[model samples]
Target: MKVFGFAGYSGSGKTTLIERLIPLLRARGLRVSLIKHTHHGFDIDKPGKDSFRFREAGATEVLLAGGQRWALMHELRDEPEPTLDDQLARLAAVDLVLVEGFRTTPIPKIEIHRPAAGHPLLHDKFPNIVAIASDTPLDVQLPQLDLNDPGQIAMFILKSVDLA
Candidate 1:
């Protein structure tokens, strides 16, 4: 599967842009899967839930299955976090994988930049950044995309990955 990524600082509209792009890509008959990496610790299981209890009881992995879906939660415990390729191996096959984060993972990515967010541009530091999407136009050598134009951004992503 082709892989692409979105990288930006917090509140830079990365999630919003991805939310808009998913449907556009799906409508084109492409199966797209996403892997979002967050710096914070998170939980999908609720406290007092069976899965939560099982995990607390020292289960290394807990699989919760329902009629429509299933989720496997593996406790890292003392294990080092898995690499991007390792995480990718756990996902089902799809035409494209849109990674939302893992900025330094070496995947081709679009740097989402909003000057109003008070952050410096990242494209220069990260050579893997193939383009920049911003709310305001900036003078940069790389291809620039309007952050408000999801359609245009979606097309660019497809073309970049050769999925168009």
Candidate 2:
């Protein structure tokens, strides 16, 4: 399966763009999987939840299973985050894998850019960027897109990955 990514600094609309793109990608009948990267200490578990308790109790991993849904939380215990290949191996086969972070990797990516956020364009430094979804045009040879246009942006993503 092919992999595409959204990469940008914090609050550059990366998450928002992916949120809009998922439905459009799914509507095209393509199976999609997502990998979102988070920095620092973030928890999906509640303080008193069993998973939370398990981690606190020195269990390195916790898996909660249910009829309709299941979640597995693994505590690294100071271990490093898994590499991209490691993460990819865990995903089921699909038409595309849309990753939300992992900026320095070699995977092709579309950058979600909000000029007002005042962050430098990642394309300037990262050659992996295939396109830039932005609120304003930049004086670059790369393809430009309006960040508010999810339909168009999603289409660009699909095309960039040759999914179209």
Stretches of candidate 1 exceeding 4 Å from the true structure: none
Top model by lDDT, which number? 1
> Candidate 2, which segments miss by more than 4 Å at Cα?
none
Residues 37-141 of candidate 1: C-alpha lDDT, one tens digit per residue: 999999999999989999999999999889999999999999999988999999999999999999999999999999998999999889999999999999999
lDDT of 2 by residue, 1-164 (tens): 88999888898888888888888999999899899988877888999977788889999889999999887788888898898888999888999999988888899898888888887877988899988989888887888888889999888878877888
> What lDDT would candidate 2 get against the real structure?
0.87
Against the true structure, what is each candidate's TM-score? 0.98, 0.93
